[model samples]
Target: MATGDAKLILPFNSAFSSSYWMRWQTPVCFLITVSPGIAAALMLYRLKRRRGCDHLPAAATWAPCFRGVPPLVLPVYRGLVVISMISVLYCLLRLNGLVEFYFYTQWTFLLVIIYFLIGTIISAHGCWVYYRQRRRQGVEEGNRFLTFNRDDNVDNHTALVTADNNSGGKLEDKRAGTWGYCMQIIYQTCGGAVMLTDVVFWCILVPYMSSAHFSVNLVMGCMHSLNLLFLLVDTLLNSMPFPWFRMAYFILWSCTYVIFQWILHACGFSWWPYPFLELATPWAPLWYFCMALIHVPCYGAYWLIVKAKNTYFPRFFPHSYVSL
Candidate 1:
């Protein structure tokens, strides 16, 4: 092949070569993979400081206290930072005539980033509402101050509190406050947005038309199935009270998805959903396999971050009186 042909083939060809796969995937993969470890460290740090702080302050407060700006400001600032970086990179790629390559992958990659940006805004607004309410109640009485001690070993804490206990001995059900209601709305809205986006992308934008010369439905369907499994496991991990049980569930879910993918591939079907995986070369399967491996770790890190935030951040934890 000529040099131009080689240039065209390299990325796909390198996918199958173990050494090349490691070199290109490791940097970003490692950052995403270790995110959970970083989150764990942060969680421990927060726990250590929990005794002195009454209610866990909003993430926004910690951001500014830890840095110079308030924590709420950080997400917006970070979003702008990401936009700036993408803009700079886009310009550089345009100058290099690599912009066309980006267009091919933009449907999925760009949309994923956009979804996160929107989700972050919703989360920030929820945090603001939560913090304002906490401020009104005063810190000492706030629920944020309660911290889980690893050494406590109290099994009774896992018992489900009844509506009566939650109501402070009152028989009537308490009404949730404006902030609490708003937070629930935001959570449901974000979840809906993600589901809608995924539907459009998988069902419409990337659909497998009979004329397209490939089984788009099979590939996309399998990928979406795997994604659903991931989402289910992630939700269970976050909601489950026992950490060990959550870990076990996650492991089992991951293995199931991996096995399903292999079975599909061995049966002569393309199980990878991403459009980039549609190539005919041997490299295509290998690349998808690497991606599947990388996806679990990246998502696990995200789960850890979200779990820690809800546990350590005041805004996410619900209050008893607020319901009234």
Candidate 2:
């Protein structure tokens, strides 16, 4: 079956010359492709009645990554950095920073690691502030932490005094927010990038590429799947908001990659990392167009996972869910 799949993708010409994909791949791919449209349409069904998709206030800022997360959530964020760092070290050691024209997956995987590392630092600092403020305020009671405040305004929420300036203004407006805004952008974006890059690599690229004699190593599999696994686990554990409008960031991330690839090709790199990225193919335009469309569903899938957690977990275990 693997070899047959490879033969089906013989070349750019195969897209026109063959009907094999129509037999099996078509139905599956079609369903994957259309589901996003269906989801978006359904979401917009009430668009007319409502002002628009209501967004979390924290999600609107560049900070707070949707604030008031439980301290336990810190470990989940840290775990991503730990796992991704290991994966990255493994890749870097093996590849030794070799040639550049390999795959966009590697680039995106590295980006995710950096994203998590930065977020981990920011979240850690936030957790520290969260605790220190409580201690200072003398709110030693356990209930102080239980009150979930997702607001971005820190004036009343946190008692942590910002570094004062000679002019009597709080210097730079410091608090748990110092890292929250930027971390929020990267965290939301990395979620989609990690999922899109891995899902496509494992489901679509691997079977086809491996059949074409591309070596499928254990490390490669780990690199792809581990990212999604870590993020999914974090999502299930964390109370952070995952707003759908953040799909804008995901799309921009991919476009920036495409632009980078183009710049590399302009300099000297002759090969396209992913086959679909090669523009000489007759179906290249379609490939690019489909990829642009794919981002919507890829992001929405994660969005739904977060949404389900928010909607159902509270009903099943209200007390436990609050702690999440």
Candidate 1 residue spans exceeding 4 A from truth: 1-77, 89-112, 142-324
RMSD of candidates 1 onward, in order: 16.3, 9.2
Instruction: Give the best candidate by lDDT.
Output: 2
Local distance difference test, per candidate? 0.36, 0.56
Worst 10 residues of 1 by lDDT: 1-10
The best candidate by TM-score is: 2
lDDT of 1 at 34: 44
Q: Kindly give the stretch of ten consecutive residues in candidate 2 with the minimal lDDT sum.
A: 1-10
Candidate 2 lDDT over 213-251, as tens digits, reads: 565555666667777877676666554667776666666
What TM-score does prediction 2 earn?
Answer: 0.67
TM-score of each model, paired residue for residue: 0.30, 0.67
lDDT per residue for candidate 1 within 128-203, as digits (tens), equals 6446544755553333322222233432121111223456422211223444333332332223223433454556
